[model samples]
Target chain A: MYKGIAASRGIGIGSICRIIEHDLTFEARQITDTAAEKQRFREAVEAFVQETTAMAADIRKRIGPKEAEILEGHIVMIMDPSMSGEMEKMIDAGQCAETALTAVCDMFYGMFSSMNDDMMRQRASDIADVKVSVLKKLLGIEDVDISKVAPGTVLVCRDLTPSMTSQIVGGNVAGIITEIGGKTSHSAILARALEIPAVLSVPGIVDAVKDKDTAVIDGTEGEVYINPEGDILARFVLKREEFIRKQAELNSFIGKETLTADGQKVELFCNIGTPKDARKALECDGEGIGLFRSEFLFMDNTRLPSEDEQYEAYREAAQIMGGKTVIIRTLDIGGDKDIPYLKMQKEDNPFLGYRAVRYCLGNPDIYKTQLKAILRASAHGHVKIMIPLVTTVDEVRGVKSLVEELKKELDAEGKAYDKNIQVGCMIETASASLIADLLAKEADFFSIGTNDLTQYTMSVDRGNPNVAYLYSAFQPAVLRSIKNIIECANKAHIPVGMCGEAAADPLMIPLLMAFGLDEYSVNPVLVLTARCIISKWTRAEACELSDRILAMDTEAEIVAALKIAAKE
Target chain B: MVSKKMTIKNEQGMHMRPASLLSQKATAFTCSVKINYSGNSYDCKSIMFLMAACIKCGSDIELVCDGPDEEKALNDISEFIESGMGD
Candidate 1:
């Protein structure tokens, strides 16, 4: 078994078909007829453009327009005057077309590779790709037609390029193994977009595998088996079937409302960090935006984002959500997230020090800018303000007062806004959980941030490896706190949502349902899976399991019980 | 030469798409379009040069256009950059 980067999730069993790179070796000689050489270079470029354009069209239809853009970029890159023109200049000086192409590509490749930005650095690889394709054209070499590969063929290559990936027929390729490339590389992105199981950056994979060799790919685990034992292959076959069956089940849950077996409906939402991610939440069939971390606008900028900038960001998300709830968590920074511009003094224990709501309330100018922006955005859709790290009732009240002040200011300025926009508290601290009823009465809603709740409740620094074992939302103490927070919210007739990793855990879903969680907000990709899990348990069954879990004394015993009762 | 200084407002500055668009638009003009970033001059008509400049969001750069249509070129390119390069 070989370990590699798991680029895409799924299991695939197939016969290997190694994609050997073509040799484009050529003899360089001085040419007296520079005109003819320049013509040769231009023709080769034209041919490259024609072929790439066709492939872009095919990929656009087969995969997506976004993936097609990678191919379409090649045409634009090669046609750039700095590219083709430079090559022609070198060719006009009596250099061979191959030499000219290599020289110009190398220059741009060096320019892009030296950049500090990751996205700009990827352009260096794009230059290399263009060089190879144009070189192949000049050398009169044929590419391996990936579209014609036999069904169930697992492709082994050094690295998958966008042009080569464009020819892939998803049904024909069962899996892909590459010698180099990471999860975010073009190879991985294309493989995932095609929905083909892929294991990338496997060392010596191309040279080790032969055509027709049987292989089993556990893409989820990033493990590959070459000509495995009969029993191992049989086990993998069953695993593959189970994965496919599970995926189909999850896909069927899309476009459906979140409901329990006994017909209790709940909100299924997604946690997003940026405005653009709202589109992904919609794509994943999320009912609303549960937690929109508003720190990206500040973290990604050198200076503090202006009020107009923050408003545009919030309005963009609200517009994309189309009236769905967008709970914007105002700047939860100064903990592990240190922005240089903020100039927050270094603290001995940052997480326990001035952070989140405490920092915001102290810095009224910054806090008011964000609050007013959010209030202005509320006019576009269902926008809510969620205060983070609220340990005291005054923190929630302070934020509410600020919102009220901002609303009055907006009214005086004759600015249109949502007057009834909800202000909520993110119950993450032990103090907040203990005084949940007070917070529930003061705040409009509650969203449990289980990560920090578990940490503060158990006095375990999740970052400390030695204490990591103690940091789990399933811990009896943490579970009880979650239960109390939910009960407090319910008793006050306010909606309570959970926007933490535990909210989507299949084992934890039933307990949350039993606790009467009004909303579950998880990663966008987990929406269907969470909805599917929620549909499996009736309230009575969940309550019985929760009762048993709540009666357990230790985390280990409760986890064991929950695991046994978990529905797959 | 006509020139104007502007900050790149696009979330991702001078990436493939923006570079391509800027270069294509610049190529249509009968002028020498160049971007002066961090004391370095980059040909705006070349996507390769524009991308290699690595001008990120919030980077203040000068757009210079020299030739018969320098005024028109500078105005158009400055407008495009100010509009976040159609991002």
Candidate 2:
């Protein structure tokens, strides 16, 4: 059993089809006829451009413009006289066209691959992609057309680019197994978007399984069983069938109110990073957006987004929700999110260092620009500003004052905005949870960012693989902090919600429900699953179970109890 | 010859898109354009050479242009760099 990240939800049992990336190799023979070689190189370039242009159009038509833009870049690279000119000059220097092209491309690729920036490093792959396509044209080799893949085939490859993933979709691919890629890698995201079961980051998986080998992939459990024994195969086949049935059943819960068995309604919201994700939230029947991470706007670009750029993004999200609450978090940079333009000092422990609300509060110009933009977007639809990593009442007060100042500025400028726009704070840090009552008085609502809360409370770096085993949301200390915050919010008479991976976990659902969490914000893909889980349980029983589980001393005890309770 | 200093404004620096754009513009001119950064000069008409230079964000590079249409090439390339290659 190969354990990897379960990127998508579902079970897929299919014959494995390994995709060995074609590495082009050629002999370097001296060319006496420079003119003919140059002409040949030009012909190859022309063919490459024509092919990429057609592919771009097809991708645009099949997928969308954003993905097609990758192919469009290749077209520009092929047409760039600098690249082709270098190749032509080499041809004129008594070198074969293939040798020249390879040398020039390798030079460019080497530079790109050595870059410190992730985006720039990805450009190296882009250059390599163009090189392969051009080489194929020159060698008369057919491109790997994943679109023509046989249905129900599990695609096994080293890795997949967004362009390759787009082709794999609608090609009847049952599952995807990649040897490299994290949960947030392009292939994983594409797998989730395509709703195909995916197991990623399984080292040497391509070599372990041969072509036409029957494989069973459990995306939810992050396990891949290759050519399993008779009993295991039979069990997996049954599991796959049951999973399909459960998926169909979950679809029935769509459009249905997220209510407990006793008719206690709980708001089901979605967490989104980009404005484009708002559509996915809507499709999942999310009641609102609990956390619209604003950092993506800052992190994806070279510089901070202007007020207008931020406004358009926020407005698009607000307009899409159509009065449904959209909780737009302020720019939560620093920590794991390093924006180079910010020029933040490298810290020994970044997670506990100057990050989130601290960074925004320090940079007033950056903070106000985003504040003004979110407030401007409020005029379009329902928009609330939520501050992240707040550990003090003073921080909440500070942000409120900034919002007040921005509101007055907007009013003076004759710009209309939601005068009653609500403000909230994330109860993620231990200090924030402890002082929840003080914050609840100033803030309109509270959303527990459990990921950080767990990290901070346990004093564990969740990203550290060494200590990752101790990073559990069900840990007694983390649960105690959550319980304390919920109780504090209840005392203050403000609704409390959770916007973290914990909220989406089926095992944690009952505990959070029992704690009387008014809202549950999760990834859009988990909305229906969460709803179904909520619909099946009574709030009172969940509360009772939560109370019992909270009394447990260890995570193992809580897990055992949860399993028993879940079975009951 | 006309030389002007410009800072790379795009977050990604002189990446493929910006390199291609600059190279395309430079080739359109009869002038020879050289970009000098960190004490090294690269042919501005070669995208491969420009990309290999790895001019990151906030780097100040000098654009030197000579021959007929030198002024036009320098002005256009300067404007493109300043615009952050339409980031």
Candidate 3:
């Protein structure tokens, strides 16, 4: 067994088919490179370009356009006149098909590798992708489908491109182990969306697993087994069955009310970043929309989205829920995610640096545009807008001021908005959670953003691999922070809830309930498990547990107590 | 070459981003634009050269343009800079 960054979540067993690797530097056969040979190579390259363009279109048809955009970017590079000029030069230099192809790919790869542009870096992946396709075509293996490998097969390769992975039909895949990529790469993103059990960045996968040998893979843990012992196989079978059963249970909760065993009703909302997620929210029986990250409105396009464009999207979301609560988070883009137009500098520490509401406050046009859109769409359904990364009372006042200013603009312009729309803030930073009482007095509500609160309280970045485990919302400091926000809201007569990754944890649900979390929002898939956890405990029982956990001082004691409580 | 000396007030310095923002706006004019920092000048249109200047947060830089719209360009850019990149 080995550990890897878990890209997708699941467990499976399969026979290993050590896939053919394409990582070798191209060793082109020599060519006479006469005028005829040059002409032939250019024609072949053009053909490849045309075919890839068509393939990109097909990719769009198969996957959603967002996923397919990764390929469409490549088509632009392939058609670049400068790139074609480079290839023409290579063909004139008397290089053979293989040699010319290698030279062109290497030159393009070098240029892109040195590029600071993220989009160009992503485009480079396309060059590599097409180069692989051209090579497969050259070898006469382009027609052989990977589905021929049979069921229950684990495909192992030195590396697999996004196109290569996507070509492998879903549902037939048992597991996938690769020599390259982390969670952020394109292929990994596709794999994750498909929910295939996968492990990437594994070292020496080729040397250990023999072809045709049975292997059991745990995608959740990034573990692989080769010719496992009987005991291990027994455990794998049980684990696999348990995973399936758990998924079935989560699926069973489709359109069901989220009622806990003790009948304490907690709103289970879906944390989404896209309009398409509204469908998933409805499918999961999400009672309200907890977090609708509006950054997508700013990203993936030139200039900010128009008010009507934003209204159309927001209205679509509101219409989908049939009057369900849709709590939209105003543009939270910052840190690693930034717009070139925003004129932001690289900070030594991005997560803790100026971002979110600060960026909005600095660029009032952007915020006001968003506020106008949200206000305009409020008539569509139960819409609530929340400000992110608030750390000061002044920031809360600023948001209120914007809402008022926007309202005044709307009223003068005769634009309609729900006059009674609720405004709220996310207690993401240590400063915000600490002074929750004062901010709560200003805002109508609060949602403890555990992702950042855990990071700030423990000085551990949840995204940082080195200390991600230490950044636990269940940790005493983090729990205390949540308790403080809830306690403050309770004092100020405002409601507080949690809408972070921790909100979905069954083990933490009891602890959260004890702390008086009024609402819980999680991933769409985890609605039932969280609901089940909430149902098992009463308000009084939860209040008691909250008091005890708040009184505890050490992380160890908190974890131990939660573990014992989970068992009970 | 015409120029306006200015300081970056947006917490971040007069570095790459403000330079880029200023540069992007300047290119809309039918004039050539440049920025000078600490006596070294750079082409305002080049994001690379501007970023390479290594302007830290809360630092100062100068903006210059040589074209028919240089004055208006400088004035608008100066407001963008003065307003801490604007809200």
Candidate with more favorable, higher lDDT: 1 or 2: 1
lDDT per residue, candidate 3, A363-427, as tens digits?
89888888889999998899998999999999989988999989998999998889988999999
Off by over 4 Å in 2: A1-12, A15-36, A116-121, A142-227, A242-266, A270-289, A292-382, A387-402, A409-417, A428-441, A451-495, A523-532, A538-559, B1-87
Per-prediction TM-score to the true structure, in the order listed: 0.96, 0.72, 0.63
Docking class of 2: acceptable
Between prediction 1 and prediction 2, the one with superior TM-score is: 1
Best by lDDT: 1
Candidate 2: Cα lDDT at A337? 87
Q: What lDDT would each prediction earn against the true structure?
A: 0.92, 0.86, 0.75
- Give the C-alpha miss distance for residue A101 in model 3, angstroms: 2.6
**Which ranking of candidates, highest lDDT first?**
1, 2, 3
Chain A superposition TM-score per model: 0.97, 0.72, 0.69
Clashes of each: 0, 1, 10
Worst ten in a row by lDDT for model 2 chain A: A162-171
Interface RMSD in Å per candidate, to 1 decimal? Answer: 1.1, 4.4, 11.4
Winning candidate number (DockQ)? 1
